[model samples]
Target: MNRETLVEIKNLSVDFSTAKGALHVLRDVSLSIPRNRVVGLVGESGSGKSTLALALLGLLPDNTGEVSGRIELDGENLLDVPPEELRRLRGGRIAMIFQDPMTSLNPVFSIGTQLVDAQRNRHPQLGRRELLKRADEMLKRVGISNPEARLAAYPHQLSGGMRQRVMIAMALLCEPDILIADEPTTALDVTIEAQIVRLLDDLRADFSGSIVLVSHSLGLISELCDEVAVMYAGKVVESAPTKILFGNPRHPYTLALLACEIDPEDEPGEALVTIKGGLPDLIDVPKGCIFAARCPSRFGKCVEEPPLCEVEAGHKSACWLA
Candidate 1:
């Protein structure tokens, strides 16, 4: 692992055994996120975006799933850590904000109780009064209008946007070194989503920690991420600085994703370009490129899986043509 890297995933693979067979969810996925940087993981639904996030946090469901790889955090291999140590590291050194805030939050407990619990978990020595004070302050920082009033409310009492803000506050209270937001804004309205994005930007600026943003929106990735990784069926197809990936995408899958989004200046009647063919079933993955069936530029070489090769400085693409 690089000394300067905050989180490094090397040759990571994850699988789940079902009644049918073994489902390969992540295939040789590797990524490096440096300190104080934002790396966006973008792909369509069922592209293993959320799986990768959960794997990093060691939060996969037990009994059916298996994970293997080197997941190093701040030079320590988290994959090899003991269960007790991993538990301690989860909320103290790294935290995760799940996609559905309502589901992540407790419907029965008061928001204050949840936030205070999180605070106490991190700083157990802090008194109850101190924990409450800190929780209120964090709530305010996350843009809640009346921190005291909202703290008394249950998760169901608050709106979706407000619940998400509370979730962010809870995550921030831990002062984690790396924050993983898995589709954090997927359930909010446009106005609230923009506010959440801005709040994340402000938090990142002040916290000085690495962030892993997993989302399906290309526009959001372009606006908020410094670096981008494009995922296909179960592997990263391309990765580069935000500008480079958006300006000159080398993988057909990446190009298809970008094309699916409508351009502001496009003609009124212009039809969106949709990628033909659906993602391959994980239980029976094809031998060649996962995207070769839908790739417009695929050739005979595409029948054999292509390695992720460097296409340019700091840019890599997994495509035979690239």
Candidate 2:
């Protein structure tokens, strides 16, 4: 691992044992998030984006799911750490902002109580009043006006955007070294989403910490991420810097994704390109390339699983064509 790397996921895999059999949710997913850099994991729904995030935090469901390989944070392997140590590292060293803020926050308790409890979890010595003050400050930092009034309100009392801001505030209260945001702006409007993105960028600049943004929108990733990883069928097909990946996408899957977008430069009568066929089921993944069924450039070699190969400097793709 590099000395400057904040998080290193090496050959990570997650499996879930169901009544039918073992289902692979992630396979040999390796990634590195350097300190203070923004890494975006972009994929369609059910591509194991959220699963990978949950696995990194050691928060996967008990008994049903199994996580293997290494997850190193600050040169320490998180997978090998004991449950007690992992628990302490979760909120103190690493934090998560889930997609749905309403469900993530308790409906029964006031926002202030939830934030105070979260703060106390990381700093046990902090008194209730001090925690409350910190929570209010965090709320304002996240762009929530009238934080004191908002603190007294329950989760149900706030709008979706407000609740999301509250969630961000709660996640930042501990000033974690790494922040895992799983579609943090999914519930907000475009304007609010932009605000949230800007807020996260500003926070990253201020805190000098790494961020792992899990989203399906390539546009958002292009805007906020320094690096991008494209996942299809539970495995990454392409990994490259944001500019290079968007400028000249090499993998067929990546090309298809870009073609699907409606560019302003396209002629009025031009037909939009869409990748045909649905994503493969995780319960029974294909032995060969999972995207081969949907890929337009598939050949005989595509029937065999292709390992991720370097196509260009700092660019890797898992396709025979690449």
Candidate 3:
């Protein structure tokens, strides 16, 4: 099948002016999201996964961060659009389910009110009765029972899982072209996390759009993503189809991440292997390969940075070894 390209990011970079200096959060990053596919951004903390996701949505703080790059949606570059056009695009063609639903949701407003407000931008003509009906249906679709009662409850009244579901429903109510879920299952229990993941998996068929799932959990990415991009030190070190990435990872950073995945069958005394050394300083990122400091396979050639090179069909890795 010839899948459509829903979003394209080219030479994207973001830097923040900190007390110390300019802290680079993203560097020359580029990727694409195909229509109706779930792509995951996987990396440890400080890897700029969430930063890239926010950049896609134009959510970065204007004054604090300097962003340069083309965020192309459909055929037009979003950076070139006016603020009003970007605002219209946000809640209409694109929507985001923030990591913390509690913070994202207005504590004073009832769930129904929030849901109605979510659609207000796109459906101003919708009557209250019609909006309420749509909200109830979306709630039920996300596996929330007693949808009518839940709508009357405030954000504080709902459990973490329920709040997350409500947030998902809100993001999807308008049927956006792109859904950016930043750590959708964070802070939930194991059972609830599994449930949320399954719900998102089921949503693919119902919502005809692409999904960018930003997470650090390789297990969740492997289970839910059709493609994965591995980020490190503000750069994408590797990207490929999910199965290929797991079976034949190219970048040393990608392999290190796999090494850290916990196995249920491990002996009681077995210690989880951790990636040696901490993340590089973003304010002063290495001039050469960022992972060279921790990479066991690093060679003298790694002293110079490597551009993303295609190692095989549909698989690319940024490493001298590749």
Candidate 2 vs candidate 3: the lDDT winner is 3
Q: Write the per-residue lDDT of candidate 1 for residues 1-322, one digit (tens) a residue.
A: 3326788899998888888888998999988888878899998878898888888887776744777888988778887888887788776888889879988898889998999888765899998789989999999899898899998999999999999999999988998888899999977877888899999888877986778999878877888888999998889999998999999999998898888876745421122235677789899888988888888998999889999989998899999999
C-alpha lDDT (0 to 100) for residue 320 of candidate 2: 87
Off by over 4 Å in 2: 1-3, 63-66, 263-273
Query: Each candidate's TM vs. the true structure?
Result: 0.93, 0.91, 0.95
Highest lDDT: give the candidate number.
Answer: 3
Worst 10 residues of 2 by lDDT: 264-273
How big is the positional error of residue 150 in model 3, measured in Å on the Cα after superposition?
0.8
RMSD of each: 3.0, 3.5, 2.5
**Which of the predicted structures, 1 or 3, would earn the higher lDDT when compared with the native?**
3
The segments of candidate 3 whose C-alpha lies over 4 angstroms from its true place after superposition are 265-273
Per-residue lDDT for 2-77 in model 3, tens only? Answer: 8678899898989988889999999999898999999999988888988888777777775446778888998799
Model 2 Cα displacement at 131 (Å)? 1.9
- Residue 158 local lDDT, model 2: 94
The sequence of per-residue lDDT tens digits that candidate 2 reaches over residues 1-322 is 3427788888898898888787898998888888878889987777889888988888887644767789888778888889998888887888899989977899999999999988776899989999999999999888999989999999999988889889888888977888889988877877788888888878876876788999867777888898899888789999998999999888888887777654634421122224677788787878899899888788998789999878998789998888
Instruction: Give the Å error, residue 105, model 1.
Output: 1.1
Lowest summed lDDT across 10 adjacent residues in model 1 is found at 264-273
